[model samples]
Target chain A: MAWEARSSPTGCINLLHGDARNSTSITVFDAKGIHTYQPGWLYVPFGEQDPHKLQRSERRLLQRDIALLSGDAGNVVRIDPAAKQLQTADGQTHAYDYLVLATGSRNAPEEVSGFAEGADHFYSEKASLALEKKLANFTGGRIVTGVASVPYRCPPAPLEFTFMLEASLRDRGLRGSTEIHYVFPINRPFPIQSVSDFVAPLLEERGVQVHTFFNTETIDPEHKIVSSLEGEDLPYDLLVLAPPHKGQQVIIDSGLGDRDGWIPTDHNTLRVKGYEDANLFAVGDATDLPVSKSGSAAHYEGHVVAETIAAEVQHRPIRELYHGRVACFLETGHGQATFLWFDYEHPPKPPKPRRLWHLEKAALNTFYWQLIPPGRV
Target chain B: MAATYQIDKTVDAKGQTCPMPVVMLAKAIKDLKPGQVLAVYATDPGAKKDIPAWANKTGNTLLETVEEPGLLTFYIKKA
Candidate 1:
């Protein structure tokens, strides 16, 4: 059984389904009927992308040979890995020979006091659209954008959003009047050292206030102030935060995950640590790997998992292994972008931002559905 | 004359980009015994840095590199 959160399961199914010789039945259990291209949500508030265009029926993106269990029947309530069976919310029991958990992480605004009511975010479709309306009505004041916690999906998203927001404000003639404060929990602007070196100066040049080591402690909606654990208070007319994230609730309830709900997974093998021989694997944000939880990471891991499962089923030697490869295009605003590619052993050395890379990123967005899930690229 | 190592496996990654070239090399090298040599051919410029980094991280020995006009061939010994 394949679970859904991001595109990992879909990519895995595409590879496995393409093999005509392999007659193994593929089934996907997804409660959400629509699959959203999450990265596009960054552009939704800026009116650069329509939220509708970023989504498609999950059934349509999948291969015809695969069976899809959606709605309540697809909502997995419990996963009994010891029994090698799954129980759904619809009161149905299903057994599987191999289980791949791709149920990704979720934004947990409730983790921070008053965060859900005080802050606006672009992590979800509803939130992005809501921010769009709020941005449209904005006049000018203090606008704060930052992360509430660590290990969130799309590690570069907060930086990208900040840059784009600055550009958007300038275009709307609100740049001079508005103060953009970019906050980070860590001392650096980015997790990767080289990338931080490249970005820190850029933010400084833009006059974007940088607040490092500011872990959000609480938000006062009435006073419109965000306080940090370090005893610093920031006043803002508009608050945008990349909320704290947690793994799927079902995994936590079943005692399969850590206190934060992240599954303990083998870094090299992509297998659930203790369930290595049980034919159980965790991909994307479902695993507690020391890697960025981005769609590109998921795509690469999906490829390896597919190959590993395929080799096992064919009684062949499994050779494919995950090396924590992640590639992302960072938009630096004003129609220019930079590229980042790195693995577990190497750090990223991002080139100077260029218009060409931005165009390539736009092109990738246009062909995402065609090239990504089908593993065409 | 320098002694030459015999190639036990060859991975053609001439047209691949970042990650794929190294990914292919990793997969092919796994099938070889320790001390056996795996040859990887690539055109992606990133391979020059990535292949060696991967070898160093995985504890493999990069025996030699043959660079032509448009292609690079790397011979790595499994460690």
Candidate 2:
């Protein structure tokens, strides 16, 4: 079996390496050589973790038997699924027996007017480092943190960042003098009802102002005001917005994705929906799955897809199926954390925040590369 | 009144968190014969609801739920 996997360093390829290394020949295409632990970005702005520690070389993470195509030769330009071929930027064409797309979503701060110039975000390494420096400055006035659109990766990230920011300010003796506001598009603090029930009171008790139903429209950088579609304006001396996200542009160029560049994916099989019989599959944030665009979802989906593909290669029955399972940890600052775990039929009921959970989250971060990329745990 | 049944297997997921308990249950139940019973002990609060939900979705029978100090035991019969 010959497999063609395209994306930045993704969990799917890693899982494929582990599952089908003997029966299948796997080739991964990724122009970018660096892979970052994205969840660690939230801790960067708070000075809790170093941004440099979050990244690793993509080549080093893969097994030696797995082929990696990097640089311009690895940059996929067009994918002709009908022809079962992929054309890279280097003018090379490669055919595949099967294809798996893991081209994850990217932050589109430019989608919101003035957002690129006005807001400091923690979605990328450069942006996170810049925000860390900006946050380290002495004074604070009005700080606002929220999102610009939905379907963003890690739904709890903005909220967790807000909580950690408040704690950081308190530690710096700026809590009393500074005003912190949280703006959200929905009516609740979080999309999940149980999690929101636990978080809302904590926000209130901490005196963090909440502005619900405030969808960010534009930012007036000159006056430091962010206007919402709901005919409201929030003024802030420092603004941090979780930029809107969209699927990769290459997906759009290939005409293989929806308007937002997300591929139509089968929720259960993790296969590309329209071309189900074509041996095409999608995973991670690139898929139009009604689940959080978090690494945990990708990891779970990766396992299912890897198993299905490996079984097909071995002429065995495909027994594995995805149940929309996702698990994520929410950091609530002050060394306390909680987690959410649920699937298609079940909704998440977050447990009470505990210091032990926080320690567990930290431990996971420490062993992420060893556990996830190797498919060891 | 304490109700008892012959437990074919007991999975002690004690001190384990979400996903682990459910994942362990899913893996353990696959080896059981039809009508065989599997018991799981967990400490995560979310497991109290998750275990039952998992049983319902997997078409298994949740025979009983017993709660003690910092512990939860779920009895599930394979479908």
**CA lDDT scores, all candidates in order:** 0.84, 0.82
- Candidate 1 per-residue lDDT, tens place, B1-79, comes to 0137687899998865454466567657768888998999999777887678767656789988888899999999999
* iRMS values for every prediction: 15.1, 15.8
Backbone clash pairs for candidate 1 read none
Could you tell me which residue pairs clash in candidate 2?
Answer: none
Writing each residue's lDDT as its tens digit, candidate 1 over A20-56 gives: 2365887788887677889999999898889899988
TM-score of every prediction relative to native: 0.81, 0.81
Q: What would the TM-score be for candidate 2 when compared with the true structure?
A: 0.81
Worst 10 residues of 2 chain A by lDDT: A1-10
lDDT of 2 by residue, A129-154 (tens): 89999999949799998877676888
| Model 2, C-alpha of A263: deviation from truth (Å) | 1.2
